[model samples]
Target: MQKFFKVYIPIVIALILTGCKEEVKKPADSPIKENEPSSIAVTTASILKEKPKNLAAPEGMVWIPGGELKQGAVPQDKMAMQHEKPAIDVLVDGFFMDITEVTNAQFKKFVAETGYITTAERAIDWEELKKQVPEGTEKPHDSVLQPGALTFKKTKTSVPNLYDFSQWWHWTIGADWRHPNGPDSSIEGKDDYPVVQISFEDALAYCEWAGRRLPTEAEWELAARAGKKGTTFFWGDDISVLQQRANTWEGEFPVTNTKTDGFELRAPVKSYSPNEYGLYDMAGNVWEWTSDWYNNNYYKEVNTTGEVQKNPQGATIPFTPNNPYAKEKVIKGGSFLCSASYCASYRVSARMGSSMDSSLEHTGFRTVATVAMLE
Candidate 1:
């Protein structure tokens, strides 16, 4: 589902922090001696030097030799969302990530081998869903509880209310990874396209069978930035640069897509050039799932420490004020539906949260393999 709620203070604070500022000078009469190695510093240095055993790269994946990232939106972006605020120094360990989003062909292989069924293909559990809803509320109709997914349908005219995303998204029965639009649609010729209509659990299942796992939010952002620091977009600060670099809406969103980027919907996995790290579709195509539980204020926790966060696993619990009972995971990289006039989440630092059980037509994911996997 589209998230358009505006809470601007956090992002404004992030923007202010990104600008050039005077460095704080140490007190001349401070008791601690300068250059004296603290325990934290010593431990951080040791971790940086420790190397894991070399492993053969998984096919269709590339190694990201991660370092510290200024992980958040840059000051140049006035459209920065509140959740992308308070850019912090985060350190992630090197890991192997898929070169592109998990393709339909790849997911098909996993399903065929395991006979796995995705979340969207299963009937909804009314008993479990009732716990999340208000007590004593009337049960939804059986048709509403049928196996289905949220599918995007472009509007014939400009939507009267952009915030009401229901205008473009519909719960369509028989719409899963295989039948993207509905029962009438098929993935017959779209083997190379990134798989969509996936949930966090569905992606995790594929990862388990493949002997991989979803990347942590920190790792995903680091890779998407592609070694670039403090830039609005992954490529650069200029918004115009996105014209040929990614698959995002080129016209007024929901109403019409000009297809200036040669795509009305999802483009092939690597339709655009790879990022500096040799990772393709790192910016758009489909939002990739991360292992971390989402928390809008998670960045504040990262800033509490002087030592760089090493592969942070996000908050202890997922936090969504609107849906407290829904366990949500972080999704990064935006998707084909992103538009400057509507959803600008295509920016590297942007973050979105989706329920673990919620499947949508625009959502997909990639997997990551740690060095330990080799052993």
Candidate 2:
């Protein structure tokens, strides 16, 4: 479940070559940990009744009324992972969220206007890369250090196990959001599809340009739950309906994708029905970035009191045993790579940390606007 196989390019490249098998746990594989408060639960059950401002909803965004959210995996979720455990209620003020993951057309516009360059299009910085990896690690060859992003290359046949994800995820040169598959791929006719290969930094830049911001993990969950209660998925608990409801890896992952949803990869936004809040692609399509510093034990801090945390921003600094040096931010939703047999990250409570500078074929993002910002 460690999507950060590309978290630190140099480290991951070395690890993949040696078949590093250390288990990298995510929301789908980890067991719940005992309660240990890192800080006092200061924020408590609070709700914002009136909208922050009465401005009309921004175009292509919807209003998610502030409410009490049972954030994280509910007890009913048999497939829950540790990160989504200790489900805690959180309060978020009313905000406007993009109706879909930011589209290729949208990102293209931003680049054209601002002359913005995505992380994938930038050359690897050895100095920066080394900081995120262990000491004494040798720099990668100059040739392999070119600009690129992680692209999913499906294995022709089944592998021994699903744990080693490096078999399918490869670092491909020139695989930016514009060329999702690599140098050969282009987003030409797919303007409406959710843009992939977007790093956390790229998403933030886009948000600033658009006068919005990435949703907090809490806000993302609140919007994804879409007024639903006790449901494993944003749509509902029924796993059988996922194939029809979302564009997830419908077949054996890393080996075969049956294209059961008419999309072997990403589908255009709004291919499926929207959630109760009129949010599309909230449960799948691609993982969306949230503006929260990820800490594996942060949930315990908020859940200790069993009270709703108001607009809970995450950890002050990113820390996770899996990728200790990698600065990560919480990314929500799942992707087309998600599957029930493998990482069923499409569940509403499912969450994972992505290295801020890492970009992948299966990752993208959406933005949200506070009512105050709208005013």
Candidate 3:
């Protein structure tokens, strides 16, 4: 979903015109209480469950078997994040995962049943922020400026040079699961498209309603690998001929997309071939959410535990400096944004983070159901 909201010049303009241009500063939000003084004495080794068999997603997902496998980047691959470092041997219990992300039709069912309104669709409580804005500066009646995720373009700039994401992230008022592009855009014709603009809470709500849960970071990575013993991607290690497999950036990212993958926006679930495990679009399409809090030092911390972590979730603290949004959770599997020019995170080992409260067109989730009976 890289700039799907803005890759085309006309769409970008439309976003600005329809979007509110208010700059609401992130307040001193609640701390993620990861550092609870009363820590549980549980260890990863003690909570190990029996491994389950692999199977295909019933209708929405694929099966990921639990077993011992490499859990991080191969040695010499520097692209691995600090949290993805200290590659360790990890084992997982078998689980059923959505073959692809939850589609508009599938998610719509959950929303209809629960009547859940996602965070994206909710209007900002501007009244709460009235005192925060400068006294002299009045908010624009037509401009949008509350906190919201922006769609970025690949400008003629280096990766490190493109830090100013404010250029693309917008604060749309009516953007949500049903209206992905914004208030004006609807899911009427896009039932098969992956649902977007979903927050972590939004995803959790849907999973609960469906009797599923988001996968742990380890489980998500294992499933994305799709039983490719030593391959780099879910299909295979060699991404040299990636165009045939995943729907990633075929040309310049952010600025230009050749649409070699045959899609300028999101493709329908299972649009691509499945892996050995029968999982669809595991590498590209949308960045899937995991049930883990983010921490750059999480890997190092796990290694010292002397056993596997049980249904582990990430710490609530933001490990990066100046990134108040660091407290956000981890997401894996690169979106359509992956490219040699930037964001080469389409690999199975690649990882990224996003704020739990924030939503983006590129961000979505799949369900992981624990195997009821392990063989």
Candidate 4:
């Protein structure tokens, strides 16, 4: 029988490129004015008129007027992964999404109410893990089975080898969502910061308790695009502008972070200007979990349908060449670790995946409520 094990691994890749360009000047902070003839506003208006009279948006959430979104990267996007190719149009229904990622304070409330224990706080199951490991492989020490989560520590020098992600990621005991760095660290005063070290199971549990659900990959991309279709970043194609618009690595990967955007680690939600759809931290902060099971060729399957996929829920099953036995889920928006010299997954169309049971220092999530839920 196929078995599953929760293994800690840093799945980010550092793509190094040359050619430094001049920094783009920051644009004036003009919020998306109401009554603007934007696609997002128009769709939202229509939905309000047609929705059930009792339909009301949940507090702390904004309506995403979903419409046709050209998902995936364009042919010219060199950084685009194979899975992000052959950009196709997809349609999703309007839904209410949290304006910011679920914050530490928000998650604390859920925990306080439900008395839920996150996966990281629970000990590993060696009996189940043996199924994934090759037969006869030595069992790890009992100490290794202790509760823990993956934590990122910047290296002392520039890492020439990008493939060896273990150079920066360390599995630390007691590093759950409550103690992000380890047992010693606490979220005490960082109530406004986005909660990290959250596994897919933890996020789902929070959603269930809150009467919400995680957004589908399609819905996530649509909201990240924020009515600006085909743009490299939500703000635009000029990567130089990223320093002012999102929280991303501004120096060498895994070694140095200049904190050019006023943050070396996670920033408080809404630290930057909101996207066109009034969504904050959609590009960078922490990689937000989506409800889709990951599959590299899912887009290919959708394209073969020869019609716009309405509310595509992503692949029916997860598949990854890295570890066939490990089930993975889609994660988007990149994080503080993303940089031009390293993991530049902050682009609107970029995607990443992690094991469903794995939790890390840079991963968090938001919740969504659909029209059906409202009714």
Candidate 5:
């Protein structure tokens, strides 16, 4: 699993070398024009053509006009890894997507309305353990069953090379969406935070209840790119002035988050500017779950299947090219915790996985759908 290489960095470097570089410069003044739709104020009316204000935010989908966009690394920068190799031409169809990640407030409403219990909210299934762990590996001691992971702060004095997730990810028993830390913790003040500890099934349930569905991996990526064809980021390639653009690691990775991005964990929904399509926080915030299986080679398979696949869910066989414990659903968009010192998956092609039974504070979700024809 450790041997599996991450493809984002190398691809980004390669793209920088060959692709037209756009300096990521922050404008001193607001760039919104009177005639143009404000990225922050996008309403459903904009996407669906004249709907109620309440319906505006829930436009629920965006049209990703299909076209030939550069699919992989062009120059193959040394930093570019092999998984994102063999750059190819691919296209995607228009789709509707949530304007923001499902917030704790929204997910709480789902639970309140349906009494739906998330997988992590329930006890671990003992029967399932038999399939993975050694026969006698004592049902994971209680100390190991705690909720939430320990986020370390790395400083000049602290070690930075550690990748052991267990050192941070503690399997706390009472840690679910409502209690991010454990039963002792609560969501009382964190209603605006992205709902975490959600399994793929949990996200699906919420989407189904809301008359929506999870976005395919392709749809998610297209949306994340926000109609900015061939750009490294939804806004542009320049990585500087990052504090104003997206929520990401400010200082050293796991250990020392300077909170320069105005956040330590997750931020309120719509806290950041939306991409060209009016999608907010698409780059960095929380790693969102998509409706796809884990497969390192999914992109290659997608290329072969079709150039403009409508819904490109990943292959069925569980496989994580980089992170092995991530053997369930695929996650996209690196979270606020992402850092160059550690994981640089904040890019468009980056991927992640979470067990159907497992959930974490860093994991959340958004929804998307095919564009609804004007009614």
Candidate 6:
């Protein structure tokens, strides 16, 4: 079989070459829409046969009482990308999850106590960084290298199309979780907001300190679905009610924000209603890190077995034909930037792979604990 791709923009190619940008499904990979029944075989990873007793409930944590899960896009999600198809069934043990994303106040406390610094706070090592780029790529001067994170910038006018992500995403210097927008920006009075500009490493550090771990992809989907099996959007198949349920972009993406949802950027945790699991910001707000090493073709493997997997952790190593040099982890739950016109990653089964060291204003994470962790 012969495959060919047309490169419309050089900047996007450069971003892809650098392996710095967030993953977006190509227009060619757009989902098929029709009144179609879901292909997912129904099975419940549902319920613990016996609940662990005598374990005190952790603060701000809830047990995700599992039920049925179809661990991929349902037929109702017309916007689902090619990668989200071939939904499969799986079982997950009950685990306690943070009610909301790790908040600024919580991360601040961790930094204050441990004197730890985040990836966005460290100066860029061009030599190490360029490894992800081409071998002959020109290096910028030392003065140009600074610590920062990627941030979304609104374009003055609407772009011709949504294919070029670089039109809206920017790598700004001096931007971090504390200074979300930039060095000039501050998180003061927004302690309740989810922490952004957090890398996978940073999330792991926080999880370690909290005596919890990042949820596996299966765990994340199970929690988000919350027994609402074989449905789109985790809330239901209704895209019309997305505004009322999540803090996703509600206007011309990266151009004009109608603020229909009353937020132009990331909203405070619990700004929207929690799902059936009592977990807030699981569908949107900020993309949360997961423990899965994203393999672009892993879903195919899962479906081929035709057997239910138990407590399935994702691929042992990251695999994406787009960027082999970058070891990426799965980031679930879209962000405030996601919209129908852009990436509607808020769907429960929607997934994206981000570089392990990559940090952005729209990216954050939560923690989860097992019964053993408490006992």
Pick the winner on lDDT between candidates 3 and 4.
4
Residue pairs clashing, model 2: 27-81
> How well is each residue in 1-375 modelled by candidate 3, as lDDT tens digits?
123233233222223322211112222233222212223344335433444335334565555666555666654343444456555556676677777788899998888888898876565555643443334444444345443443433455433433334444554556677767676777898888888878889999998888888988888877777665545577765667677788887775556789988887678887888778777878788888888776667677776875645444555454533343234577888778677655667777777666666677778888888765323
* Decoy 3 TM-score against native: 0.76
Model 1's C-alpha root-mean-square deviation from the true structure amounts to 9.1
lDDT (0 to 1) per candidate: 0.74, 0.78, 0.64, 0.75, 0.60, 0.78
Candidate 5 versus the native: TM-score? 0.76
Candidate 1, residue 264: the lDDT equals: 88
lDDT, candidate 4, at 36: 22
Question: How high is each candidate's TM-score?
Answer: 0.86, 0.89, 0.76, 0.86, 0.76, 0.89
Query: Candidate 5 — worst ten consecutive residues by lDDT sum?
Result: 14-23
- Residue 52 C-alpha lDDT in model 3: 36
Q: What lDDT would candidate 4 get against the real structure?
A: 0.75
Q: Which stretches of candidate 4 lie over 4 Å from their true place?
A: 1-54
Q: Measured by TM-score, how close is model 4 to the native structure?
A: 0.86
- Pairs that collide, model 6: none
TM-score, prediction 1:
0.86
Q: Write the per-residue lDDT of candidate 2 for residues 282-375, one digit (tens) a residue.
A: 8778888899987777777766766657888977887766555556788888888888767778888887877777778888999998866766
The segments of candidate 6 whose C-alpha lies over 4 angstroms from its true place after superposition are 1-50
Instruction: Please provide, for model 6 over 274-340, each residue's C-alpha lDDT reduced to its tens digit, 9 standing for 90 to 100.
Output: 9988999888899999999988888777778777677889877788776556688888999988877
Deviating ranges (above 4 Å) for candidate 3: 1-59, 76-78, 126-149, 152-160, 305-311, 314-318, 372-375
Off by over 4 Å in 2: 1-46, 50-53, 305-307
Per-residue lDDT of 274-340 in model 4, one digit per residue for the tens? 9987899998889999999878788877768666667888889887655555577888998888887
Clashes of each: 0, 1, 18, 0, 22, 0
Q: How far is 93's C-alpha from truth in model 3 (Å)?
A: 0.7
